[model samples]
Target: MARHPVRAKDFAVGEEPATVVVGLIASPGPAAEMAEALVGGLARQMGERLPGARWSVRVVADRLVGGPAPLHELVARTRRRLLDGGWQLAVFLTDLPLQTARRPVVAHASSAHGVAVLSLPALGAVGVERRADEAIVRLVAVLVGGGDAPVDVKPSGDDGGGKHRDALLRRLRELGTVAGDDRGAGLVTGVITGNLRLLIGMLRANRPWRLAVELSRALVAAVAAGVFALVTNDIWLLADNLGWLRQTLVGAGSVLAVVLTLLLGADLWERAPPQRDPEVVRATREQVVLLNAVTVTTLVIGVLALYCALFVLSLVSVLLLVPPGLHAAALDHPTGFSDQVELAWLVSALATLGGALGAGLESDETVREAAYAYQPDRSLTG
Candidate 1:
């Protein structure tokens, strides 16, 4: 049986554990969340790798220190802040999209210092915190230099095959030299486990209440659309003449059309000019903007759904409120239940159009912030 060389005992630094403080920069909400997760995971991973190390994580709030700046400059500024603040490490987590060779890189660490930057977009709708944990561990490995084994940070999809993988691995090895030597195989397996853990964590994070709050405004628009659909009688005859399938398609198509219109008018594709002082590359920023646009579109779809439901309820109200004979009299060529069904669908389409007004009522900043989960103008108080 082969013995595993890297274990808890191998990391025992001394009786006195060293403490490392990490500074987090970015949007307040997400930065705070990321800071909490990173700090929590440090004791678990680093304790095994460096048993005598203690880690503290805090979100940085000083305008003089944090904001949407170029990565190199952000890192340099953060380094100075951390050092002056008597901290050991600084990590800037940004929602800004980052890519290398058209492929997303989740994180990058400076070889000369204990500073690192991670992109939120690279987390890609999964165990974001778990990926962060793994990336942080890899960063620490490079900064502290304990494990002699080469570190591999390539994300799941690498198109370069053998040469690319080998070159990246060599570059990582050259980053720093550590005290212990272990085959790279175990480290690879650990990272794979980290990815799996992230998937599960994301699943748990998606609770119903959070989703409800996120879509509350959209739901309000849907209800308003439904109300407008119920009260209007001009389209009843057209609806009565149309087939169920056609009605559904019309309703769905209307919702989609309005959504596209909103996306175009919203200017989600606009990008900030490149900065020279900090020197940043925004190759993947458009993709992030596109994603936010889609999110806003989804809200439009949700409003349409609400409007349909309310329209149905309003139609039912008509049936209950008005006498059967009266409803038939109201329709010129009424066909009983069939006429009502047609009327409902036709009204839904129009109501969905009205929902566009509600969407427009939403402030552009609100929609943008909701789409990305980051409040750009928000400043940390106290």
Candidate 2:
């Protein structure tokens, strides 16, 4: 008798094809949100793109990488979780920027362990979700296709001549350059474009605006100093005579002063130890420099926000208390909205300087915590 083709449902439960479970372990906040949102889509894509396997995805919101650790250690930890959870593959997504002594790393995959770690900041500020989706897919493909022959191999029951695998590999190359021998871990380092993009991503992940909110004491001091400046004739005279150039210099100087005071007072700067190995020392120095840069940028942004707020308040005070005629008479010149704006600008600068004094009240831990939510507990030598 003619035989019909065998169907999947016709097979016994035990004889059915094995399902490949993929786990997404994400750091708290943005990384976790992205992982949760992408899990469903990723499962569908994995099933469609890598044929002949029943694919499933699970997202766990946890901090897998709190600080810098050896790449192998990170992979091993992830591997343990994968095995314990009965997952075939695992990926850890972190918002913190990852760098090697050579370059910033976008992703690291250990095919031997069936685990991957991706730095979200390396993907840039825009289209992070899309890029992350593509990155996870490529990583999954790498793990499934085998590390040695990532691009050339065809999936089981796939007769399309490895086109899908080649396409995934091509996309991965576009994201970053794959390095390291196939016998162990593989690294994907960003190019120049990727580096610039990574910097932007890091800045966003820092969430500089939070610094403004945390500086409650400083904001109060600034408002007090601004109110004192607004009612003084001397400040009005200074504002009237100080040209735009002088005003700009004063504002910049005030911002610099506040940033310096915070950095020094809070001990936010990282200092490398003298007794560590030479390689560790060098890596620590590099990381310290990068962390300091990010911290300084965050402070500047926060101080500028404070300055803008002071300026608005000063302007309103000027409008309400100092009449246009009085402002003109005090400066011995005709005054208009421009005069009011200049006056507000000068007062804001002076108030920002006063805010610097208040920064002393904030503890080192508070500023550090505010500025770096994902800051490393200890610098990684690698």
Candidate 3:
């Protein structure tokens, strides 16, 4: 059975299959160049596969276009154009936005029977950007289209689950090696941690959210420091109160933080030396504004955090020492209150450490700096 397609008959020959629109929806504001290239690649591949089967290409700007439209609402305008205008098979694309954890369900409802891949949804789940994910997206698209009549995709019947899981594990193993670079894998870690860093910076820059995160971190720090101080000052306090298992958690948490910090910190990361001069590379007004601010904030927070960590470390050391010192002093002068005052000082220091660490965890910006690193200025007077 042959049916003429909407506006497609003008181009498609008789007996051509139903019209398929290769619509490329990109976040227009950020990566116009990249999206354009990917769309072109998709169109070319579909054309080669379908062979004069009437392929039309269109790009939707989701950003300049604005978002927050629910699934049907978001694609309402586009869907109308595609379905009414006669696109039987519609394919969509988008960058996985950091703000939302779950994808919009309405996206599924909007499609009359379309496929969305190379989308922010898929790339996000796979933990990679569009560039790295381009090939994977192509493979997925071919699968959705029931395999290319031009190039048949084998169904191996294996579900490819084993291979997919293996690839995921391999990527995870390389996370320690390529923690920051956009080129490599470790997408799972990158998306989760990198997105959090992005959100923290954004919230910090704005007033109300900034205040909220700051207050929350401060509170967490206070609680952490207070708890640690109590545990340290009275070594057997928790053991006496909660018994061995619960008391052990306090020490375990401390040890875990040390291990995690070392793993995540810039010091442990093996970054390749920058090839370009940061100063020579002229940043756009916007990049300079955002990157420079993030860079400065990171440095300030980092310095403050270092001092705070040292303070906590010193206080902890003092906590370990003071109890014995105070006991001896109290024995020598049983009525003296100076020993008690020193004990109070130790508690304050430990609490301060916890507070500082909380702030540091929130504000650590080293990876962000490396990701968008600038060329160093070597234009000093000779």
Candidate 4:
């Protein structure tokens, strides 16, 4: 008989050859894109390290673990699902922010379950895509046993002595145990940071050309309103009657109202839920609500700032068209610096209302697309 090749189990000098399934677990946002890039093209890169194993990457958008559940419970549930799905190893790339103690963690892994979770926010500021790739590569090493892995698989410190990596390992070891409990310490921090990411995502979704068109429309409407006020002598009459304080408050209120209306009418605050169950998607919906509020507030503030700038320019243009000296002769009331200030406020307030009209010109689809542009296309997940 021909000599039998060494059996896979008998070849015990090396780690067992296993199928590692990288699960891109996300909340239906930009994090999905980050995960797709990481997992879809990860096999070639990971092949250099775990040459004996097979790798499969899939987007697990359903069954999110970002809840009040304990760490171990979360890990166990996720591990069970992955293993039952025919994966020996599972890794989750999540957009939700994760932390230990009072500090944020970039990634966490549990070798016992062969599961790892990476927090997308940890790769902050810039170079997020590159950092995400590096982080996953290192985390995978931990899942497969770090010894003899590729050079780039190191998490921190020279020779594995890095404090950051060590701390991460400590946390990883405590997964699915009482030792890992932090009693929701990370929730507040996660919400705050997650909202910031949401705002950035929304901004990124709005293309430059779309923003320009919207801004131009608003400016034209505002200019028309301002010029009409000046030409019809409404600004002078209102200025003579209203005090500066009242004028300022009215202008501020107008902008605020228009902003709120746009935010509400456009339904920019709502998020598309990825799962079917109401209870399962509740936490995600809450996150979307908080993030939507933040994004809408940021957009409103930006619009108000721009409106102020244009209002000043319009005032300057008005002065050039009809000087203050000419205004005094035509006015029934004495024209003074205070009056001019009041006129400016009135014009700004009226212009804000005009902006509401301009905002209406934007198609509903454009607003929705711009609002959720950063969100991953669910169809592409398949």
Specify the highest-TM-score model's number.
Answer: 2
User: Which should have the higher lDDT, number 3 or number 4?
Assistant: 4
**Quality of model 2 by C-alpha lDDT:** 0.66
Report clashes for each candidate as comma-separated counts.
2, 0, 9, 2
Model 2 Cα lDDT, one tens digit per residue, 1-382? 1212224543356654346678899988989999988987997776555544467898988786668754544655676566555455789897766644335567776543457778888777789899889888877776555332334335425656445544443332222221122121121122223333333344555667777677777777877888899999999999988899999999999999889988898776654345345433433333333345556777888788888888888888888999888888899988899999999999999999888877877766556545653322111112
- The runs of at least 3 residues in candidate 3 whose Cα sits more than 4 Å from the true structure, single-residue gaps closed, are 1-19, 47-54, 62-65, 69-72, 75-77, 81-86, 95-382
lDDT of 2 at 89: 72
Error of 3 at 9 (Å): 21
Name the candidate, 1 or 4, with the larger TM-score value. Answer: 4
Per-residue alpha-carbon lDDT of candidate 3 for residues 1-382, written as tens digits (9 for 90 to 100): 1211223332335543323344555566444455665666665555443332435566655442354432323333443333333333333444532222243221231111233323344333333344323442343233232222212222223455334323222221221122243322443345335434332433232222122123346446745665666546363232224434543454345434433442354232222222253321211111222223433344344433433444465456545654655554434544224443344344444454464466446533322222221111111100
Order of quality (lDDT): 2, 4, 1, 3
Q: Model 1 Cα displacement at 143 (Å)?
A: 23
lDDT of each: 0.48, 0.66, 0.37, 0.53
Cα RMSD (Å) per model?
15.9, 16.1, 20.2, 15.8
TM-score of each model, paired residue for residue: 0.42, 0.50, 0.27, 0.48
The residue pairs found clashing in candidate 3 are 71-106, 94-120, 95-120, 96-120, 277-375, 278-374, 278-375, 278-376, 279-375
Clashes of 3: 9
Residue pairs of candidate 4 with colliding backbone atoms: 72-176, 157-162
Stretches of candidate 2 above 4 Å error? 1-194, 275-282, 374-382
Cα-based lDDT at residue 103, candidate 4: 39
Model 1, residue pairs in steric clash: 127-198, 145-178
Per-residue error for 176 in candidate 2, Å, reads: 11
